[model samples]
Target chain A: LNVNINRKRKWDIGKLIYMENVSAEDCIKRWRNEDVDDEEGGDSDSDDSNEEDFFKKKDENSSKESNPKQTIDLEQFVPYFDTFEKLAAKWSSVDLIKNRFIRSAVERK
Target chain B: MSNSKSPLRIFEGHQNFRLRIVLATLSGIPIKLEKIRSNDLNPGLKDYEVSFLRLIETVTNGSTIEISYTGTTLIYRPGIIYGGSYTHQCPNSKPVGYFIEPMLYLAPFSKKKFSLLFKGITASHKDAGIDVLKWGMLPVLEKFGVRECALHTLKRGSPPLGGGEVHLVVDSLIAQPITMHELETPIISSIRGVAYSTRVSPSLVNRMIDGAQKVLKDVGCTVNITADVWRGENSGKSPGWGITLLAEMKKNWCLFSECIGDAGDVPEDIGAKAAYHLLEEISRSTAIGRGQLPLAIVFMVIGKEDIGRLRINKNQIDENFIHLLRDIKKIFGTEVYLKPVNDPESDDFIATVKGVGFTNANKKIA
Candidate 1:
């Protein structure tokens, strides 16, 4: 298959970033469940006739993205939203701030 | 260092806030940015931008970041940069190059020799590619006496399905600021590129090369472009193909451009587009090429307190370049002056600035 996709494949990371009230885990879980449902559907409908339907669902899910919104119109394409959403969900705020430390004992120059 | 005087006050909503943050960290200056995209329909900071700020905070100690409830308005007080082994999961919204681009400026002056592993998109049509750093940035670092620097790609991830990995190891050193006033007239001695295709027909690489060479040949340039092909496991999680061209000049300066293969984009057109971009760069007599303005400025700011000069094409002088120059002046107290260079062949201009005499702020690692 000559898959010429214009859209780069990640999900909307901006929507899932760490916020004060919003839990990163919750965001990840919600997206991951959605992705799980997608995969199950893809597996069950393993026929050439269902390929069109598979792609149609992809376009609908990813059409409302903001980033890379208008750089070059790739036109109706499905990106790897599930992978990115899963990764973002897995990344913890603790992971981002793990090695953060302040050094004491600096001589005045 | 007078503590009595007030720090610089800057208004917000600028896209290049990372540049300001990096400079402030190096200069040890506190900056307060207000109204950060507050007026816009989608107000406040975006995910990748905030992630960049967090990365800066992780790399330094005693640094402070204060953000308002709405994600608009910020106060950043910088501390000494303590560079060491660190890994970051770059947000999928932007490519890894987005993070690595700033590291090119901060890594050499770090407290400890640093090794950074960045995971995410490696290449996108919208962001700088790993190849740009390999061919364009690494050589510029070497010119300033930065030793043992390595930028290597472990995997290739294209935008949207990014899972690419890259390892960059840089040695800590007090920069030897240079005086790059004399530019060896640029002559394209050779053309080299990587035509990368992932999960696609291996023959796509050849078609791209053939199409690109045809364009270069018609222009009467007879240099053969060497091509490297990455396939299967090496090519990241997604399927894509594109070409990145680096034209080596007789002088240390190099000009580079890239074009990724799009859906329905002809392999020949991808190759020809990259070749034409290179030809356009060749026509301009500037020492610094497009997409390298910010880098050229960083080199000048960090070099020994001598004057560094660069010539950029007139059309390339956009608002971002102008604002970056202004922010450099604000943060480092250095001035970047512009003058029109008289070139009949092209509308090129010159910019010159003296270094702030910046040195590593962290205690030497013993």
Candidate 2:
């Protein structure tokens, strides 16, 4: 009466897992939650209330299991979009100045 | 002053040897390579690699290269990229593209403009052909705001006997590259190709074009492929035929794929194979083609201090790309962050990185 317990692994766990189709805000929230989980796991040994700890752990596990998708908020990690906007503004201003100069030169000519 | 910093030590075989040397040169860092193919029976650098080293020495100034007796150990102290008019006769073992690829990286940062003449096999199975560099890589450079460049294939040379010649010219960048933030994969506007034959029957070029068009007709895009038959002196020492296809996308982005005819291969097979390769590249739906990712990434890392963004397919993140990322981080101390694009249908990742602001120290300040 031996039951086969080994499950076939579909993909390599060591390989990088890219979050699929997720927004920036949700990605930040997920990262925050992961940080909180890590902190809690590190201090779990100091907690004396076993029953309460079990229920808290169970809720956290259930919530994580419910949401399988993850996202990355690039703005939070780096100022990429902000930099692009700034550059665009600078470029427009430069173009405006150049255009005015060209118009003046043409009129003088 | 560079000698004050300790030389970077690298081990193992000659994988990414050209890239390592290029990075060292650009960064002005000395590098010592150990155990290059030490375990193998030959246990030394290949003839082509030594030829490439010689080419590097010919192009640069004040560079010191020391190779050990066994050619397994090498110490290279990089100097200023003093690019100017020069001629190099490449060994027949590898095509001219092998040398040209690294030159493309070094050229824009050089003190003087590059007008290089290379004599070797123009088209081969080992590396990108001269046509690919012309139609594929040169246009990609334009995206980085580098426009004054041209590659002219003077003669069509295949492998083995190898009597081909190409002239390459590139203007040095006056300032740092503009930030590249193209994240969207544009729609392909048209497909254009060249089916070239050297010392072969002129009809073979037409057969190759027909074979390519047969595969490309169903794509619903304007397909125009021309035949280029070289004869007499223009045809190289070896007799060969090949096809290079380019898929022109919107916003002037291009994807290139090429296949060369081997000794026993037919022209039709070569053309069809090149077409299929292009189709595969198109299907990847990346802003930069998979083969051009490393080059694009290197350019992005050395761009202006502002962040540059690019869209890359997840499938393109192979082992070599990872190695490139690690090497870039080690040398330039810049890292690229990848964020998944919010599209369920596509596996695209938007890679963003703050450039290191690496300007040419050799350039004179006005």
lDDT of 2 by residue, B303-326 (tens): 879999999876565445555666
Candidate 2 off by > 4 Å: A1-109, B1-3, B6-11, B364-366
Clashing pairs in 1: A4-B263, A8-B159, A8-B160, A9-A80, A9-B159, A9-B160, A9-B161, A10-B160, B177-B303, B177-B304
In model 2 chain B, where is the ten-residue run with the lowest total lDDT?
B1-10
Give the least accurate 10-residue stretch of model 1 chain A, judged by summed lDDT.
A73-82
DockQ of 2: 0.02
Model-by-model DockQ, in order: 0.01, 0.02
lDDT of 1 by residue, B44-138 (tens): 88898888988888777778888889888888887777788889899988888888888888887777887999999888766678888877777
DockQ of 1: 0.01
TM-score of chain A of each: 0.20, 0.20
